[model samples]
Target: MIPSLSEATIRHHTIAQSFERGQGYYRAGSVHSLIQRGDRLLARVEGSEATDYQINVYFDQGGITRATCTCPYDYEGWCKHIVAVLLTCLNQPDRIEHRPALATLLASLNREQLETIVQNIANEQPEWMDAVEVQIALLTQSKTQKSQKAPRRTTVDPKPIERQVKRIINRYVEQWNDEPALDEIREIIQKADKFLEQGDGNNALIILGAIVRAYVQDWMNLDGSSGESGAFFEELDDALTEAILSAELTTSEFQQWQKELKNWQKEVVDYGVDSFEMSLTALQQGWEYPPLQEVLQGNITELGAWEDEAPDFADDLAWIRLKILERQGRHQEYLYLAEAEGQTDRYLQMLTKLGRSQEAIALAEQEMSTAGEAWTLAKTLRQQGELKSALNIAMQGLSLGGSNHYGLAVWASELAEGIDLEIAFQTRLKAFQLQPSLPDYLKLKELAGHRWDSLQPELLDTLRQSSSSLHAKAKAAIFLEEGLIEDAIATVTQLSSYESDIIHPVMDAAIAHRPDWVIENARPRAESIINAAQAQYYHHALNWLRRVRAAYLQLGQQEEWHRHRTALMQTHTRKHKLVAMLQQRDLT
Candidate 1:
């Protein structure tokens, strides 16, 4: 019923910043395969991550009635990937031309046409062939048995599931060479999802549960030098948790599974708390499993009483109890538990939620001696309309002088809103004097507003006079910001300690205006970086070398470039990897 989406409508639905980022993604050709099926538009968007995220946007008469993406950005209603897809749709409306559903398209194709299409897909993606073959077999069986009544659902065997889990992990470990097997692990989990989609939740749970056992039993003890193995396990844990929550089981079935879990807990060494916590969460969310509840309640009581003997277990148990109490609207019990556990944030949150503002204020004031407490108290005071008190607390925290004083200063300035801009500027300037950081200086300039031009000289003077390394950088930044490229370059070159990152802007500026100077200054640093870089950093060294080459080219100094290349080759003659890398790029 809805009209085709326009760029203006997309802008209306999305925030400006998200829209801009999405536009960049679209321009980069990140969105692809955009198609319309009935009222839905689906596309694949390549994101910052290795995998592409699939986006589905359902439109109705109200424009975009619903949209979902596979990216982990639930905080924003839609992510840049979603925005990219929408922008693609707006820019290329013809791309959303109605495509027949897969079933309909398949039905219309002749046997030879279908066979050719399947053969082509199988050649490109053999994994998809398994599903297709299974479907074909199922169809043949259905046709053969069409005259008979429907058969009972067959149960999936746990042995085959366990074998599949072992096979997947073994293949991943062998092929990935100890790297994180996130993609392989997700592929295995997707098989379980297929079961769930086919109304076999119990089978899905079994598959995920088997994978968890295999991971803990065999995979955890391996040398995870790549650091990806732990992330893989985390993903596995999430899959297991999701399956436990969503899978449906009868009372007897649930009790049997509970028994198996307890048996595993006793048999396995340091059994993971993730599954147990997920079970507790399911109970908290009103899952009507009586035996599971009894088991969890007993464990909670046992762990709660063993606080001194088993502190870790006791803490976990307490968290579960707190979550349950909070969910049940038992604020009094939640408060007592929070206070007992010394959870200040939770205690404060509970107080505020219960409309006990006076008590919350009292607690906030009492906790204001610590930097973290001061910031929290100041924000709470501001929210309570006690601006002066908040400002005083923030100022006191800043005077105490710690790592977090800059944050305190910002909080104080925000509290001083409508009071006095001059006072706010002075406070921020004092913070800059204390820290001499670029961020604080910029904040001070922001508060200066219309008078920033007048204040610029004083700011530059302060930075130039300061002995701090950060202040020196700030001075160079100011020069660059004001477009005094020569001054910026001169200041950076004269610095006693040279950071390659800080020298980059100066090098870039010098390349255009003073190519000779860039060639002279950059050669030694590039040589040092190339010599010191590891195999992984070879690309970074190559990029720096490219910059040096560009500088030489800019000055039309081909002979000097050849001489520099010869010198590098002679100096690093024994570094085979470096020589090969340079020769590949014709740098040697």
Candidate 2:
């Protein structure tokens, strides 16, 4: 069941513009084909692109665990499409069709019904039979041809995949301006990712190898010098490495792959792609390594075996082993390898997952080094109904001298609520001290309550003396939030860059209280943009000039403002779009 979500929760997760746009999308009935598969919500949203974006929102008793969309709107959090689906779930729950989990649904259906369903699906698309046939074989095929550890091989031809990669590369060869049209190649990789995710490693290997062998043979035909093609290879490297690690192989088969990849590695180095180096390392260290085997056998304390800063592939290799173990339900071995590899985050998490809270709590003291490690275990502990220990671990992690994550501290602060309000205040205060932002400032002020008056001066002083390396937005916002007009003015002025973002708010708020400051700052910043003639940022420049106009009007100096505006127009007479846009957007 999807948790009952609120409008406030939706707004909190996404930006204000996205929230408003999502509301519009929902009202316009853009959210379609809404369905509930167990605790997962699926929907298609009609968007600007011709194809509708698909969205999946997962939830449980706690809340919406995660939401994802097919749309390429990767900024900070959930995109407008995801927001619209959540909004629909919140308001129009009746529009959703709930179904049992896929496994349960299949179990309930009779064999004849399932056969009819597959037959109907194949009839809908005749070409799908090629895939359907391969799947059927995999399901019913006996293990007589190979060892039980090896993955079932697909009878699907590699010719079609190779041809697709060639077609995509040749089609986009002429348009190699900045970046090639590698979205199709990326699509091929995504197809392989599905097989790898489902543990069908050999089939994934076939798909990945087809794309790589074809693309590498022809990628140099385009403009590979621009360094854009390197990203494509990097993605290929990750998928290929995962394929290599996931697929169970005989010793002879491993050496054969290593030989092939070595040649491919040599060819790719000239293109400025180093990602394949890790893939090569992975092939060389495939699970038979002695020390790794020792760790898998629960000999964690025996660190004298292989004790150097692990090769760069150590983390990724360890993760693959841990995942394989996890999938096989070998949790104890997972713990052993995780601890031996110094994956404190995973080690403590498994302890919590196994309901050994006392073990987790006790081990956290020695095992938790970074704030990230502590946060992972703390979050797991809190989810499993261990509130006191969660808060304790969160505080311990934050107070650790090495490093701390500001976002986790804020989350920890939220978890601390109803348990110990003072600890919550302290946790939030630590977040602000770590990284001051306007939101954190407001939160701290609100939480301070009666103590705010006493806390205000020190906080303001700290911001004033803060390192210039701190985010400009954070500095400007904190100062403006407190109505410290002079402090806000100084915050923007101290920065080396034309702090227009900081200045825009400062000038708006200071037009009445400090008109002189607004005029002094706005004209130069606006002129710099106009002189550069970038055209895109003209509106931003005009925005600052409007504040200047307002400041002049406030001081009864409209005539001076008019002369300055006229001089600017006279100087840049050739920029017609700039002039027209300025007049149109109320710059007159």
Per-residue lDDT tens digits for candidate 2, residues 1-588, read 464365645654677568778999999999999999986888999999999999998764435657899988867778899989988888888999988888888998899999999899989999999898868766775544222344586544668999998887787777655254576688778888778656677788778888888878888766644657767777787778888877877678778778878878888788666657767776776666677677777766646124555776677667766776665467887888888877889988988999999998998898677888888898898778787888799888886655657877876766665467687678778888888776667667666779999998998888888766556678787777778889888878755435555667777998989999888877787888899999988987888788888989999998998788888877888999777866654556
Which RMSD does model 1 reach against the true structure? Answer: 13.8
- Record all residue pairs in model 1 with backbone atoms less than 3 Å apart, i.e. clashing: none
Error of 2 at 208 (Å): 1.7
Over 1-588, each residue of candidate 1 has an lDDT whose tens digit, in order, gives 224344544543455467788999999999888878776788899887898899998753324546889987745446788888887776777766678767777887899998899899999998998899768855675422432322325666567656765666676654545553545556767987776545355677788777666665666444455756554644554454455544566678677667655554444435433334344344233333443344334433332233244333344444544554554455676676555555565666567567675687677666544556566655665555555665666666665523677666654554454455666677767666656554455566667888888887887776666666665566666677667777677767755324656677667877877887776666666666676756666666666676688788889887888787777777888877877887865564
TM-score, structure 2 vs. true = 0.75
Number of the predicted model whose TM-score against the real structure is largest: 2
Candidate 2, superposed: residue stretches over 4 Å from native? 1-73, 78-153, 159-187, 218-235, 250-256, 299-310, 467-469, 494-499, 533-540, 553-559, 576-585
lDDT of 1 at 36: 84
Lowest-sum lDDT 10-residue window in model 1: 143-152
CA displacement after TM-score superposition, residue 190 of candidate 1 (Å): 14
lDDT of 1 at 287: 36
Pairs of residues clashing in candidate 2: none
